[model samples]
Target: MGAGFSRRAFLQAALPASSALAFFSTSFRRDSLISAATSTKPQKVIVVGAGLAGLIAAFELMQSGHDVTLLEARMRPGGRIHTMRDQFSDGLYAEAGAYDFTDAYVLLCQRCFLPSR
Candidate 1:
């Protein structure tokens, strides 16, 4: 925790950086989807929520040449995932909501977030 570090500012900065990383990640192959396709017609899809699952689904659908519309109830995309700052002693912060990833989801998360070695 730094002197002028606020959750809002941190999120504002992190969002773009993370987005850029995702966009540039080697795992995000736009041509892979096209290459594996069976030459079917593109479909329109509507995805509810902007949480991790919804976002990933939408992105995958879009990459597969489908039209996707993502809807979120909150002002931000991360459903219950958020950070709380200045709520504890000595600049300690807390992460609220779905912060833990179980073993079942480990592979999916790694595939989505990590680069191949």
Candidate 2:
């Protein structure tokens, strides 16, 4: 353990970023809802894949005055953010693959990381 490497210190650093994510999420949702109510000029835009990146981009484009359509192949959005709600009797759920986000991961998400492209 080096400087500022304890669990408490790690959480102290992470809490603010988590709070920022929550705040940004709520603000974006509110803005999108308000845009739908106020906007008139609609533009056609097709976004394939309903992953986090895709969804965020669509929301931003819509807020920037563009009509957006999302197409997901897995019968639902969330790409790797898959949840299994039927696996337990107590209504507990499990997520696959998506876990433990760090600052670098958030930066990649913000940059719309697509390695193939």
Candidate 3:
């Protein structure tokens, strides 16, 4: 009861009650602990679109021990790389949609933005 009371004596007095409380805490289920401790395969993931954003997400997930698959809407990948020749001038070429990928976007382009090409 004094300020100089020994912690060992206090613990000796309190240990049984604390153990009893732990034994009766049904909220802590045994199965949950078992599942948490068990080793399992990595999560499987699928990316709906092979677009820039989707591809980036897939890359990060795969790096973290998850399996990933990229699904593209169109027959070909490149979400917006629409290149076409001019209507009148056959020699001139143009990009109808999507920004061109640069060196800064190489990894993203290779992993997510561009398809297998």
User: How many residue pairs clash in all the candidates, one count each?
Assistant: 0, 0, 0
**Top candidate (TM-score):** 1
**lDDT values, one for every candidate:** 0.72, 0.71, 0.64
**What are the TM-scores, per candidate, against the unseen true structure?**
0.50, 0.44, 0.42
Q: Is candidate 1 or candidate 2 better by lDDT?
A: 1
Mark the regions of model 1 whose C-alpha exceeds 4 Å error after superposition: 1-40, 99-117
lDDT of candidate 3 at residue 92, scale 0 to 100 = 82
Q: Report the C-alpha lDDT of model 1 over 17-114, residue by residue, as the tens digit.
A: 97997568546554554465426778888998897767766766786788889999888887788777777888788888885664324544666787
Among all windows of ten consecutive residues in candidate 2, which has the lowest summed lDDT? 100-109
Supply the global lDDT for candidate 2.
0.71
Off by over 4 Å in 3: 1-41, 85-91, 99-117
Error of 2 at 29 (Å): 21
RMSD of each: 14.9, 14.0, 22.5
True lDDT of residue 91, candidate 3: 75
Compared with the true structure, what per-residue lDDT tens digits does model 3 show for residues 2-98? 6887888888988999789757854566445335434456777788776655665566667666788889978866566656765648678786665
Cα lDDT of model 2 by residue, 1-117, tens digit: 477599788889989997998678655554465476457566788987777767766766776778789899898888888887787778788878676554334644566664422
